[model samples]
Target: MKRRGPFANRRLARFCHEEAGSILVLWIASLVAILGMTALVFDIGRVQIAHGDLQRFADDVALAAAAELDGRSDSITRATNAASKLISNPQAYGGDGTLSGATDYTLTFLDGLPAADTTDPSGYTTTDPIDATLVQVVTTPVTLDPMFLRATRTLAGVTGPAQATVFAESIAGFSMEACDITPLMFCKPTGWSATQASSIGDGILLRSGGQGAAWGPGDFGFLDVSSSAIGSSCFGLNGAKLIGCLIGAEDNVTGCYAQRGVTIEPGQKVGLENAVFNTRFDQFRGVMSQFKSNANYTVAPNIISGLVPQGNACGWNNVSASTNSIGLPHDNCFATGGCTRFGTGSWDYANYVDSNYGNRNGILEAGEDSHLVSHIPAAFAGTRYGVYLAEIAYAQTAGLPSGAILSDRDETGIAQCSSNVSTNPARRVVIAAAIDCTKHPINGAATNVPVDEFVELFMTEPVGTGVGSPPSFDLWVEVIGSAGVAGLGAAGTGGVFRDVIQLYR
Candidate 1:
């Protein structure tokens, strides 16, 4: 209560008026603000990254589910399982526990899936699962912490609970238009069970040295010839009564691209030796190989060695005079069924034609056409044709040594994973547009029909036995693409609009 000293008063004044510490105070305040902002940014970045992961999860689930829309009976169950698996599965990066399940998603079956051209992802109408061509999946909101943001806000003492939630969505589907399509067609019989399509999709239905006519999907290799052959007459008689009939045929089925308006004519024999096959096999080395379509809509060359070499050698030996009639016969072997039948022949003999050397199921040659006989005389032609046909049949029955199988399966080094067979695993797969052998054509519709399905095949062997046989292929197949109940119409923009797996929206 007494009078204060002058020193104390001066000290108080100095403390109050001093500017020396003010700069430090300002700096600390500024640093706090900057740190808060920086933390906010880091938290926002974390949220964004988590959102991206959620989005990818959506996309992956969509694709996994959509692939099940191939007109199979178990489409819904399969698709649901696919989505659940993706959602409940661990994270791709962190291996974290799953955040969602099938119940957390909204799946829609699309009759016509929205293409990339559709600006809105909602362009499609939901269809029944049985008829769905596409599947869509959306996930529930997934919560993630605003880690740095909350921490900074807490340090600033200015925020309530601060966390973020995110969601992601996607659409997926497949397209099957003539664009970028291999020129082949198969019949999807009018009355087929849903199981039939699944059977083909199941993989590796047919294989060389595995089974005969009783083996897998279609017993004989009766693929429809392309209606658009280079030459007018049946050059190699791929569609002839002798060869095609021997392989097998459907009443209303013609192997042509129906979408292009090219129909197969009745009994219109077309050769398999066209520029397309040659360019694809010989030039591109794609026999029993996989090829992706280029911008030109043509298949690119094979990356690995393929069966084209063996096929070329087989064809060459058939045409060479020095090889005599030991190779493929030009037209006569197909004209009259008298070639080396296995039962009647020995290791070596001229046996094609009326079972002179052996007895076997031979397609009676329908008389040599002048234009068709240009490749070689009867003996050479017969041997070539005979060897080819025999090899084809044998392939379906007894899958030959397999180089066509990818190295992943070790070719024939080990047993594979298929329900049908126990030996020689499969590595690569092929998707071909062909008719279903189990299906017959609509009566009185058209002479030669178009392809109604996309068949999935696993290559078994390069079509040959040992070193002497020709390059041939055997497959295990299942139907993938479907024309629905209405039959073949349009699937998508020549596969461009479709992705085996895609991210939409």
Candidate 2:
């Protein structure tokens, strides 16, 4: 309708339809898409990281709980309390920032084999709180917001809740097997059980340079279990015989007690000195602490809480150095302590300690603490003290048995040095691991060798050649876990071997 130049009009049309601006629009769209993907990734990745953290937390709680499952009375309660404390206390791990608070964590005790777990070869069960061998730990579901995802709504104009629920879980348990152990067992006459009285076990005391405190042939307490590699009997009491032969009687070195009437003749098995407590092997290490020292000639107070140790040699006025028959068995069954009942002893040392016997002959004499140890354990890593079970034996069983049915049965392999490798469930060896290298020990349930409890003991000194003076052990022990047997036979002589603590999930 108007007179206009065609070229000019064409130019204007081209400008309006220019493709340069198309690139800008395309870039904007691309940026929106890229932002959406990044935001989604942030949420997914954040949740995944949180999930991993939860898994580790679960494992920690389970292990803590399992350590307290010692297979004795109040075991469940102790385990529960231990696990709950580890979870709830922020000081235990990190805090809610790194790990979920203990309140957000939960643990469950399981007995018997679980349907989901198929890890163990023997498949030990964790059936009851009282006898738990396994524990399950779970974290409360954690909620997280996808910060990048939510932020993208302002730019990309796309949105959702951008939140996630994450959680993790794990299962763990405790068991024991024989590892490096000393051949010597301070013979515990009592088994581990609250109700087990006569068979509960007693803590044995060995005196250096005493009339009857050394190892000898025919003396059955000498064990060969302290070598780098164990040659102890795997099948029976042959180990004990071998050990007794290794450290045979060298001109009456003195290793028999008058109480047991241990008259070690030319070629007869010898017996151990004596147990201070009648049957219960209660706090022997603690009592023996008076005999442990690092200084070459230093002394420690041999403290026996209930009894006053008398020393005629040191001039404390208990009388002559004669064997006290107050608590020991007088029956001449097998020889020295040959009792009609195995693991059952009639300990009368209390009468002497109580001043009933004028002289404390058989019982330990108090003088300067003559501990022969070079290194004082529990000076660091107080959890390293321990002792060897001179003997161990067990009868076969099917399911995880409850309580110590046969506490102290007739276990062989006493004084068998090479055969002193622990193999008997009946012969329980309390093993320990050093938490640190040095720390003075304090007495408590945590350190005591309670019945049915799995303990870790550290061997401070390696075994000296059995050729010289019989090798002795300096150990630190702490109860770290408990156990339930699966394939173990009826205990024979004290059975000891490699045990393990493991996780199923």
Candidate 3:
């Protein structure tokens, strides 16, 4: 063993006590903490960026899905398809950078949303597609691997979650507004459902409600088209305004009615304005006699009303008894005055064809008859509306001119009154709001009366005050089906609906 002197022992003690390199030791010790903190900040920022990307994706999906909730039976299916296929966005940063699709998110159709965003959606959501007006979308959770958090935790011997999960959720609502719609509202027939296939082709007798009286099923009233309800376009004479709206011209009433509610016109709206409505049949009468050549008040291309000329205009009394007349007849129950409003979809089809087209057998041999038969099902062949459409088709393809005389009485399917006939056949179809009067009663000038649905009504015949004409306040129309149905010609094309979609959360 070697022995150290006192001087060497003193030098060793001083070196141990020296503090010259103390800062380097301290800095080395803190380097691990500094790196861990940096890693935490970077990982947190990446997670936040991923969350933001997911939120944007959710918002887009919700909007796309909500736009298809049009109160139809396939609303949910349509919405799901729209959401799954319409939107495709890539989530980057902390996520795996995958494109979004049906599998990336889950959708919930809701009839109503809770008052608070934090409320559970299971309680308010619905499986019924027709009733769902809201949609909620939640993205699948994305697992993130932190850049250094896991390694730092392992080195520190800390037991915790190795990976972080992040996701986003959003809610949206859909609403509809009917723009450039006719200013007409009628009580929905009892037990009528817009989605019911059986409701189509039924005849409906819409009668005007007495002034200041509560409206009921089959009763109709004018909508408030005053400047307050619509806009400045309808600021003229009350009669003229009403006639303009009924005419449905481009320069006429300009406004949109929300599906949620509408304002009822005030005062006595006595008649259905037979003169204005008669223009559609090419039979101008009363005040409408002067607009015979006006394009705005054009007549339907096929104006085959069963009336013979009485002078310059056709008279309602000229109609033939039985099925000799080409005009669409009312339901048997309605003709007998037994049914008040809705018809039982039963009519005299054979007699009608026998009288107008020389029997169904002869007409079936005509050109394009096979095509017509295929389009008009046998079940709908008896319907007044179906027959009317068939007549128009026959006139087009069977070499029977639009103006060709149908009966010996000089009743033609052409507009003799107007030179510029309406090219759009829907001129005779009135789009009216159907309201559930029992649910939301209307006394007089009701505000915000909820509408059940919008119905497309085909004018079965012209309104007139003639001896044989229906009461001026009564309107006879055949149900073409509810507007916005899945597949019902132009009415199903969503022309009446102005959809609005918005994000809730």
Best by TM-score: 3
List TM-scores for all candidates, in order: 0.42, 0.41, 0.67
What residue pairs clash in candidate 3, if any at all? none
lDDT by residue for model 2 (297-349), tens? 11111111122224311221222222322222212332455532222223333
Full-model lDDT for every candidate? 0.39, 0.35, 0.70
Which candidate model has the greater lDDT, 1 or 2?
1
The parts of candidate 3 lying over 4 Å away from their true place are: 1-41, 60-132, 136-167, 176-180, 194-197, 223-243, 246-272, 314-326, 350-380, 396-402, 447-450, 465-472, 485-501
Poorest lDDT segment (10 consecutive residues) of candidate 3 = 485-494
Model 1 lDDT tens row, 227-288: 53322222344433223222211111223343212343221123311122322222222221
User: Which window of ten consecutive residues has the lowest lDDT sum in model 2?
Assistant: 386-395
- Report the candidate with higher TM-score, 1 versus 2: 1
Over the stretch 1-505, how does candidate 3's per-residue lDDT look in tens digits? 9999999999999999999979998898799789888999989988998898889999999999988887677889999999989998877865557647888899998888778878887898898976787899999888898958999989989897888899999999877676666777888855686557677777888876654568788887777666434334344556544544444342354466767568876323444345666777776656666666666677776676666555455443343423345576778898788787988777766555555655434343344234345545464565676666666665666665544535343566677656767666677788788888887887656888767677778888876452312232678888777774322323432235655678887
Candidate 1: deviation at residue 201, Å?
Answer: 21
